[model samples]
Target: RAFSLNYWAINLGFAISSAGAGFIAEYSYLAGFLGEALMTLVCAVLVFLKVPESRPEQAAVKTVGGKRPKDEVRLTTVLRDGRFMGVVGLSFLVSLIFQQGYVGLPVAMGADGLSSSDFGTAIAVNGVLIVVLQIPVTRFIQDRDPRRLLIISSLLAGYGFGLTAFAGSVAAYALTVCVWTLAEIVNAPTQTGIVVQLSPA
Candidate 1:
């Protein structure tokens, strides 16, 4: 959920920065880069000032001898868990797919000859879809099996990306993005919830 929130903030910043870039295009690519830099700096400042540490209060407590609470199990013991290894592998694969989308989409859009306005509109559409649908989708799935949702999300994202590979028009690309956004809606919350549930006691 925190990851989702950070992703949301960055996307929000991107939308604002992209609008700034559209206006600053009269200047140069340097102007747009500077605008993005400014936005990133602002986000960094806000996070530093406003975000609180989430570490457990118990972690700050000391024993009578002044030693902090010690781990009962060794790192090697935890590392021996098969489920932990599976989770790590799944996490790596998911992260790879997620980052690849970010890097690959712009290249695909540029190749398809999308204008600035069209690209912006498509992204805005994606944001809007998430904002409107995410809550209802969460409510609908709250009582259902999360693993099933995760599998479905993977299929949706795969199909979405496959469609994007052949997209020729702005509308077609937007449609493709919409499919992936829905997948993300399902993907993000379910994975996060699972991670929290699976954490060692």
Candidate 2:
């Protein structure tokens, strides 16, 4: 339930930001960037003011008592964990693939003679669908195996990007976005949960 809410909130932010960026960019790209920077600063201020530190003094004291290792050694231990390292590598690959939506997709659309706004609209479908579906999808797969979910999501993600190769129209690109967005809806929370499950703490 916590993961579901987290995923929902993430998508909600994405939806708002995607649409807002599009509208902002339509007026002035520089203003859009400035607006994003301002919003990021506001979020940082809010976190500084409202969010509590997760690391407690007790944890530091326990570490001093040899219940926990020093930071450098702890990082070494994490690096030595093959399973965790594998997960990190997989995550890196997935992130590289997913970033194509932002970097490559827009370029591809532009090459097809589409405008920035059209690219924005196509990408906005990703945020909108995830916002609408993430909670329900999270609930449905909450009890399922994270490894299986990750595998399925990875496959869907690859296939979704593959479909983009054949895309000729904005609608086709949007369809591809929908495909990968579902993969993202499944992947985001599932991956986070898996990381938590795999952590020593």
Candidate 3:
């Protein structure tokens, strides 16, 4: 539930920012940048005012059979956990793949004669889909195996980008975005939940 809420919040922010940035950039790139900076400043102030530290009182405790253990959790111990390291590595690879939307997709679309505004509109599909579908998708997959969901996510993400190779129009690019956005809807919350599960008590 926590992870789902976090995912929803992220997508909500994305939707608003992406759409706003598109319109703002049409007027002036400098204004768009300044607006973003102002929003960041606002968010920082909100966090400082409203957000509380959530660190556990016993930072070094371990979990045994879903119960807390008294042992201290060390950075060295976390680094030594092969499973955690593997999860982290896989997450990094997934992030690299996802970043292509921001870095490579716009360039690719521009090369195909699309404008920056067009790119923004197309990419906004990602945020829109996540905002609309994240909760339902989370509920659907919440009871399923995280590993299986992640595998499906990996495949979806791969094929989502792969389909771009055949894209020649904005519609084609938007379709590709839809495919990967679904993967993100499935992958993000699951990844966060997994990390929570893997963390020490």
Q: State which candidate has the highest lDDT.
A: 3
Residue pairs with backbone overlap in model 1: none
Candidate 2 achieves a global lDDT of 0.86
Q: For residues 72-181, could you state the per-residue lDDT of candidate 3 as single tens digits?
A: 67787789889888999999999999999999898899889887777778898998898889988898999999999999999999999989888978899999999999
User: How close to the true structure is residue 44 of candidate 3, measured as C-alpha lDDT?
Assistant: 100
What C-alpha lDDT, on a 0 to 100 scale, does residue 187 get in candidate 1?
84
Please count the clashing residue pairs in each candidate, in the order shown. Answer: 0, 0, 1
User: Global lDDT of each model?
Assistant: 0.71, 0.86, 0.87
Measured on C-alpha atoms, candidate 3 has an lDDT of 0.87
lDDT of 1 by residue, 1-201 (tens): 455655565556555544455446545768778766987899899988999988766544446587645654457656776786677678678766755455676678878877665665555556666666766777777778988988888888888878878888878878988888888878887888887776566
lDDT ranking, best first: 3, 2, 1
lDDT of 2 by residue, 1-201 (tens): 688687788778887778677667778999988888998999999999999999756533345566654543466788888998889899999988899999989888989988777887889898899888988888899999989999999999999999988997999999999999899989989988888888755
